[model samples]
Target: MQSTEQLDEIWQDRAIESIINFVRSADGDFNCIEKLANAVSDPDSLQKIVEFLSSTSQGKQAFQKRPLLGNIDLQKLHRLPTNSLGYSFANHLLTNNLQPLQRKSVENDYEFFAAHITETHDLWHIVTGCDTNILGEIQLEAFYVAQLYASRFWLALITKNLLKTVIYDIELSTTYMDAIAKGWVMAKQAKPLFGIEWNLLWETPLEDVRNSLNIILPSS
Candidate 1:
């Protein structure tokens, strides 16, 4: 078996290659959302995604934030309190007896989005009441894929669901997918009808805030 160091190195290399390929595919464009959508339909369109991501305001912010974590210890991440978003996510995974994939080192603007998505995944779990189980992850992935149009992520979800169905006899992945679709629709409508900022959702309780905004939670 490969040592942890070796595995980390391998993952880092693969992640770097993926980022480079994504960037090169972009040619020289800076419209990531459109490029990403197009890339989903056409693999070669990733070049535009890379270019767009490399130039975005969010991408620049992520680039600056990454170095801050370099000096800090990652293993200490596990020691954070359960109420912390990352800790909650980790706890949820432990509660469900699921293991997370090892961290992969990434570079460049494409990597920025990767990091953002990875870190924010736990926040999604908290917001959506999704657990860390395979079924829950599949559902959350569909929601994110719909919102973000990240092709590779969507593919990963599809592969994971297929494996789960074959190995565990799961039949409810479609239900999870439907939930994501509905959630997306609700979010889109709620933003306009409720007239609340997205960031405020974190500060306020969903039910109470929804009431204030006249937004109704979909039936459980």
Candidate 2:
């Protein structure tokens, strides 16, 4: 029979391999973010997310209502005024060939968070001017960390990408660092965006929505 130590080492090796593979192929892949979150999920982080989602009236309602937006018709959004948030979001998805993420249920805080974030990830990119690229993705994760400091998933997600860039893609280190810095500062300056009723704001002008949300973009 294999020794317990040997079994432990084997498990560790598998875990490390999985992480490496994930980091290597994570670029522009939403699944990687979801996978990383799942891998590092803990009860502490879930509680922190719940608290973060409950601190504001909108967030409180979000937590209670668990609003799902993935089922909305893209054509309706597409027909909105070009300056509308819905139009921008729909265009972003259609141009990129991305589909809204479906959420079946929210049995827990983490599930609610994951589903909501997934559905709104592209919307965030549109609002924040983050491109659908590796740097933008990392920057977004850093923004999440700034807002949800207690979330191990966000922290781990940021750490892995930073390490990957530092060790394997040193040429990207400076730009990635800049992205992280920008995201952190932007989050600090902006009002909380979690648990927002985006459906209500879909018809609002994109800039109007951002202004109401007190979003401050990083300077060029």
Candidate 3:
């Protein structure tokens, strides 16, 4: 007779179902991305990911302290210089009407990854100069794929979204691929975003932050 814990240990769920569902009906829901990530996550997988991150100097620094941005007061961020990362991020949130989506209790590597990534997600858009649109989101995922900084979690998201584009939305297919290519290219030109202390750079000029990270934005 298998104990409940024994069964849980032996039984592993595949990410296919979640990926397919997100593809078919995500319609730009961020929660779908969240759910998809959660679907494929387990201790062993997260440990591998953490191990990979630990290999890089930036990732090593990031993990040594395991920085978590949590939430910030948007109003305070808005007070920063207009050309600063903080102001731009605050403006982005205000324009999109999104909360900072504070950190959850992170007791393990997976939780820490999810919490920090979620907290910094919009900040990536700001620095990358990607808009809050389908194309922009796809590009960022593609960037994440190239960097592998987010691990296989992004691979699953990009795979589903790319399939969705090709299988159903044929008209935008070319543009989608172009965006992905540009994002992939963008990765080669930048430093690791994982270990960046973005919160500390809030008052720094946005361009300076980008330059420090060696970010090469695609033309508008």
Q: How accurate locally, in lDDT, is each candidate? A: 0.47, 0.77, 0.79
Model 3 clash pairs are none
Give the alpha carbon lDDT tens digit for every residue of 155-191 in model 1. Answer: 5444445544555555765675666665555444432
Candidate 2 whole-model C-alpha lDDT, 0 to 1: 0.77
Model 2 residue 42 lDDT score = 52
RMSD per model, one decimal: 12.7, 3.8, 3.1
- Candidate 2: C-alpha RMSD to true structure equals 3.8
Let me know the TM-score candidate 3 reaches against the reference structure. Answer: 0.88
Candidate numbers, best lDDT first, in rank order: 3, 2, 1
lDDT of 2 at 57: 89
What is candidate 3's CA lDDT for residue 108?
67
Model 2 residue pairs with clashes: none
Which residue ranges in model 2 land beyond 4 Å of their true spot?
Answer: 1-18, 26-34
* Candidate 3 lDDT over residue span 1-220, tens digit each: 9997875655344467777778887577778767777777766667877887778998887776778775688999999889999999999999888888677567766677667777888988888887778889888988877765446777777688779878888888888888888888888788878767788888999999899889999885
Clashing pairs in 1: 25-47, 26-47, 26-48, 30-52
lDDT of 2 at 110: 68
